[model samples]
Structure formats: C-alpha cells, structure tokens
Target: MGSLGSRVLRRKAGLPRGEAAAAGKGGKRKRGGAEGTGDSDSDGEAEREERLLHLRGRRKKLKSTSKYIYQTLFLNGENSDIKICALGEEWNLHKIYLCQSGYFSSMFSGSWKESSMNVIELEIPDQNIDVEALQVAFGSLYRDDVLINPSRVVALLAAACMLQLDGLIQQCGETMKETITAQTVCAYYNSAGTYGLDSVKKKCLEWLLNNLMTHQSVGLFKELSINLMKQLISSSNLFVLQVEMDVYTALKKWMFLQLVPSWNGSFKQVLTEADAWFAERRREFGGDISFLESAQGSAFLPVFAHLRLQYIISDLASARIVERDALLPSEWLSSVYKQQWFAMLRAEQDNDTGPQEINKEELEGNSMRCGRKLAKDGDYCWRWTGFNFGLDLLVTYTNRYIIFKRNTLNQPCSGSVSLQPRRSIAFRLRLASFDCSGKMICSRTTGYQILTLEKDQEQIVMNLDSRLLTFPLYICCNFLYTSPEKRADSEAQLDHLES
Candidate 1:
C-alpha cells in the first residue's frame, strides 16, 4: 500500500516515479512533529504583523482627521460658528473651541440672547487691551505656543482675564515672572493688581521691597501711585540699610518729579537747578515763600500722611524738613517734639525699661489735639531710625549675643567706633572724629553708653578739635528680637563682658 501511495503521489507531482518516491520519503522524515511546529510559528508571526499594520493605518487616519478639522475650523475659519469683534477688528472663530471656556460656554450654549447671535462684541474697557493681544489670546485657544513680551503681556493678561481663560492667564503670569526686573516691575505689578492676579502681585511686591534702593536709584518710585507707595512704605517686612530719612528723600524726589513737568535727567541736577531758581525768586519776592510752600503742601498732603515721622532720627534729615519746609507742618513737628518729651519722661519713670508700647490713640490725640490727622502704627516707630551723617546702628537680641552693627556710608570723617556689650543689655560706645577729607582729628569712646533698644534717643556729642564737620551729625538705631535660646545666649554674653 505504501508503494502504491508513493506511485500516486509521484504521478500527481508529475515527476519520475523513482525520484518522487525518494523525495516523499525525505519529506516524511523531516515533518516528524518539529517541522509542523515550525510552520505554525511562522504563520502566527505573520498574523501579528498584519494586525499591527492595521492598527497603524487606523491611527494615521484618526490623526489626519484631527489635523483637517483644526485646519478648517481654527486656521481657515471655514465653518466658523461665531464672529468676535475686538478693538475695531473682527475674528472668525469656532463655537466649539470657544466653548472650552466657561465664559464663552455660558454665552453661546445657554438660552441667553447671545447664543442666538452670530457675532459677539467684546467691550472690555481697558485701553491697554489692543488687537495684537486679542490675536494672541484667540490663537491660544487652538494652539499651544503664544508669543508674549513685557509690552504686550499686560494687554494679553487683561484680555485673557476678561475672557475668563485660566490657561492663558496662568501663562501670562509665568511670563511676567520670568521677565520681571527693577525697571519693569512697577508696570507689571500695576497690571497684575488691575487684573486681580494675586500671585503675580505678591512676587512683584517682594522684588520691589528687596531691591528698593536700586529702584529708587533708577527713579522707579516716581511711577508708583500714592496707594502703592503707602503699601510699600508701611510694610514691616521692608528691609533696607538706609535711614528713614533716605526713604523720605526718595519720596520727596518722587513728589518733585510729579510736580515739575519739564524736569529730566539726574535728580541732583534738577534739585540744584530748582534750588537756584527758588533762591533767586525768594530774593525777588522779598523772601515770601508762601506760594512755594502752598504748592508743596498740597502735593505732599496725600504722601505726608503715610510718612512715619517718628522714624526720622537724623538731625540732618529733620533739619532738612525745617529748612526746606517740606512734608512736616510746624504744628505736626511741634506735636512730634511734645511726644518725644513725654516719651522721655515715661522712660525715666520706668527706670529705662525695655521696649515700651505707647497707646496709638493717645499718641495721635496728643500730637494733633484739634482736628489732627490720626496716625496708624505702620512701619513708622521709634525702634528703627534712619541713618544719619553716614552712620547707622542695628541691635538684634537673640538667644545668643546682643549684636550691634555700626554702618558708615560715604563718610567724610574717618574714625573707628568700638561697641562693647554690657551687663545692662546696653552697649558702651567709643567714637572718633575725623576732619573732612577722611582725616582723623579726635577720638572719644569713653563716657558714652547706648541702650540697644533706645539708642536712637542718645545723641553722640562730637567733641572733635576739628574746626569743620562735613556731614550733618545723626545716629539711627533698630532693635530686633530673636528666639528664646538666642536671648539666653545674649544674656550670657553680657555677663561675660561684665565679668
């Protein structure tokens, strides 16, 4: 039977019977289970390849469909469901894409009258919101990348906020943060405040506080609104090495800039020129300075109310106030003097105790007894006095040591001052006097002690033999509290010094 089957198979293959029989025997030997398994594995691999190709084709088709829809609706505006008019320009946009925002969704999807309208008019009142910003905001709805710069960011943010586009608002904030600098921070901060961007507002304010002197040097303070100025000056967190007088000086400069329309260039030059003009006019007018006084008084009324007058420790700064007749009215200055006298009496009564807290109402009432403007306990306090005569003092009490720092800037006189911590939580001071041009003439470190807390009250008497003093003499002081452990350390250091 095997022979017969071989003959039939050979005939079917159309080969010589002997050759076909030999081939069949060889094939049968090779196909012993393993050959069958090899054929089955190849078939499975082919099937998987075919399935993968099918999936790839489907994905391509889906991607092509999405691309076509975006191109037609957003780019070409070919089946746009709505038109938007902004700043005298028209934009054809799709309702579906616009509906992604709650603002637009509510406008177009509900039974409101706008839903039936084909064109929507955006009537945002901000003059800063222009056509370019609107284009960027509208493009952002369909695309991921939008160009933003300092000049356009304010407008873009305003538009985005009006549209209620959270994504775009966040993007604007991030861009502002990246681009913020001393020169541009004021504008950005104002824009953020206008649009209610709290995060951006906080960041800009912190930067301003940290780099206040830098900003002042660049005349950025001239751009600040009264409210913004008040906010900054009144913040307890503002850290500056400058005396409160420097702050007052900066404020005066800002006010001067606002008053004088043609003023330009260096503040010193403008001030010098103005002083000459004032001097010439004073002579011509027989020293009647009432007009100049009235102008300054009106301009400074809003600003002066925010000044922490008690913090001005420099006699030079205070004298400047009287000489120039600047912010502090005579009545106000008199009240301040009276307050100082009372404080001195109180300190004597308390036997020179630690920091004393005065009642705000009582102080205000006493200072301005009749129709007096009330003062709030803001950043202005006796604890921190502005630097005077190129000298500033800082006293910090921690668990460790009572630290004292005396800083001198641009001092014409040259001398070293030694500070020794005493057992009474005070520092015994020694000061040397130098003549103008940095020449040391006299030294006096003995017979003087300053309580770290009330050091602002103690006057440094210069008994220098030099016939001339270049800078007006003033001393400023500040006291800071620290942790309990630091306080203990401070006490121990005091005891060691006494021992």
Candidate 2:
C-alpha cells in the first residue's frame, strides 16, 4: 500500500513534484526533467500577469474620476487675500468643495473654522464640477467675475435676500431699478410690500398713481373695477389719498353719486354711493355719531351705537400702522376719549357716597407721585400718555388709592400686577407684562381693601375678559402702552380728577 499519507501529498499546494503533475486538471502528462515543468509554469504566470495589468488600468481611471472632484471655481486673482466667503466664512477651494459636497460639515461643525468660503463653495459642497466641462457648456457666455448669467441677476438678488445678505439684495434692487422703468417698479410693488421695503412701496404707489392721474381715470367700469378701487383705497392712508388726490377725488365723487337716479353700475357701485353719503355725514359730525346716543329716540339706536363704536375702534386700530407718522401729535389727544367716557360713567354711577371726585386733576397728581416712585425704583423712568388697560381701570374704580411708593432695594421692577392699599384707597395695578398674549388680559379685584365704597347696585360686574370690556380696554390702552411718557401724562391727567 502507498502510505496512508498519499492523499495528503496529492493535495500539496506548491510546485508540482513531478512532470505528470504539471499539466492542468485533466491534460495528458509530459514526463521530462524539472526543465519541462519550469517552462509550463512560466507560461501560466505570464497570463496571470496580463490579467492583473488590465485590472490595474481600469482601477486607476475609476479612482481618478469617482473619488476626486473635477469642478473648480476660480476666484478673482486680486482678491486672493479674501479667498471665498459664504454664509459668513472664508474658505479655500478644496475645503469649499468639501463643504459643497457635505463632507466638511462634520469638520466645519467640529470646531469653529475661520476659513472664508465662496457662494459656490457654500452651495455645491463636494459635488464634482469640472471647470472644463462647465466652460464647454457655457461657451462664450461665461464671465470671469460673476458666476451667473446677466438674465439671472434678479433671481440671484432674491437668493441673496433669502440668505439675509442685505448689501447684496439692495445692490441687486438698485441695479434692476437702474436698468428698468417704472413699469418694473409697478410690477414689483406687492413684492416690495411683502419685503417691508417702505421706500419701494412708496415709490411704486407714486408711479402707479401718477400714471392714473395723467389718464385722469382708469376708465374701467364701476361694475368691473369697484373691488380694485376699494383695495387700493384700503392699502393706503389719507397721505396716499392726498398724494393721489385727483384719482381719489374722482373715485370719491363717482362713488358718492351712485345713489342718484342715473346710477347704473353693480351692487358694489350702489354700496359705494351709500357709503359716500354716510361718510359725508360722518365727516360733518367730525366722525360717526354713536348709535346709542343717536338712538335715544330710535329703538334701534342702542344696539347700533354699540356695534358702530366697536367697528370704529377696530378701524382706528387697523389704521394705526399706515398712519403712524402722518397724523399730528395732537390727534393723540382724542385717544383718551374712551377712558374719559368710562370715567364719567363711573363717577356718576357712584355719586351717592365715597370722595365725590376722581377725574383729571386727581389722576394727574397720583400719576406724578407714581412717576416719582418709579423714578426711584430703577435707573430709568418711563412715563407715557394715552391708554393703559390697568391704569385706566385703576383710576376709574379706585382713583383715590393710586400713589407712588419707591421700593428702595434698588432692584429692577419685575413688572407684574399687584394690589397695594394705602389709607382709604385700594390700588389694583399691573406692571406691563412682556408676554404678548398675557399682556392682553387686564385684571380686576372684588374682595376689598381698607377703602371700601358700597353702593347697592345690581352687582359690581368685573368681567374684564369679555369682548365688550376687552375692546374698550384695548382702545384705551393701545396707544398709551407705547411709552412711559404717555402713560405718565395719562396718569397725571386722571390724578387731577382726584384733587
């Protein structure tokens, strides 16, 4: 028997032991000395070498194209010091590419990198952009300084605005304006408004109105265009109307005459004519008459008056944003009309007992005292006139209790609501709250303080959150809450009532 290890020797992996073993799996065997075996092995090795060479060539091309970015963004040679800037950074080409590709995010966010990155670097990141390929695609259209086409400048400026690059956006806007006409300005009026470009809106409105004035009228039928006219009127204030007086007057006259026998427009025209009649009446009365006051004789007047007052107050508020600077400072005097109304109502209602007067003089004195107290409380003192929900109610109900007490720890005021009583007066006062929603809700108290005036009425109703109550408070407080000066004046005026 061959050795039990014969199979093991047959499986040996190195060079063949004899000539018969040199032939592949099943070929005929050639028996010779070691020279024949050597020649056969050399042929096999040569073929293997050729295969590996082909694989290496393929791998080299794949690695070059797939792993490396081919796109290059060249910056100005003069601005080499600046390199690239994107999203508030300076970056090199490779880093920019990495950023564009998203590979640099971990690196960028890992620690603060001071490198300046360009817009392209910020935008494309790691994506390969072969310059040669881009140049071919662009042909003669490519410019050295700008990466985008001339036609896309507006879009680029818009992108700049989205990125919050104020300078770039403005520059683009100016450039477009320089190259275009009033037509472009008119086209973008709404866009300008959306952007809150007050200047742009002003200019666009001027252009549109000027053109309309030259035509003396749009000549559009009232039935077809009443809505458009209403929208235009609503978009602006008296100043805009005055500027486009010709247009406004024509529209107003046409609107006013719609109720006359010859009128033949849509329901909208009929409505405008009716509105003009009432507007003229309102103008003569200095404003709309209260439905309740007018209704003293008419059964419908009370409900109509209250509803009209609410509507007027709401309209006044909506008009504030557009009329901020247009109206005179003295017009602010009318702001407290509501507060005065409530105060007079309260004073008359409770006339049977308690210190009889809580009016302008007493309110002024108390406000001055409070101002002194506030001045002592912090480094800054703010006094405002107009309306404050809390202050107005405080002065109206418990006018005697309002006083100034300086809290001397020198700590800043927390500006929260408090009910502090001194002598016979109970002061339920709230410092302004920073929370916008919380600020809207005024407060009231029922329990008691040292000073109590009991009148046997139905009830001391204090639903401050009710719609009727809230709107009045809003009307009283909206302008007054603007500044400490206004609040101080209002307080002083109310304090005078006490004296």
What is the Å distance of residue 95 in model 2 from its true position?
5.0
Output candidate 1 Cα RMSD. Answer: 17.6
Local accuracy of candidate 2 as per-residue lDDT tens digits, 12-126:
5322233233344214222322336535665557546655664675677456533233323333232223243444444334443333322344545465454433333345331
- Tens-digit lDDT string for candidate 1 (141-223): 87656668767889898888878899889989998877777567888898988888889888888666544543453257567
Runs with alpha carbons beyond 4 Å of true place in candidate 2: 1-154, 179-182, 196-198, 215-499
**What are the Cα lDDT values of the candidates?**
0.54, 0.33
Root-mean-square deviation (CA) per prediction = 17.6, 25.2
Per-model TM-score, in order, reads 0.58, 0.22
Off by over 4 Å in 1: 1-72, 217-219, 267-270, 273-296, 311-322, 325-327, 344-350, 356-402, 405-477, 480-499
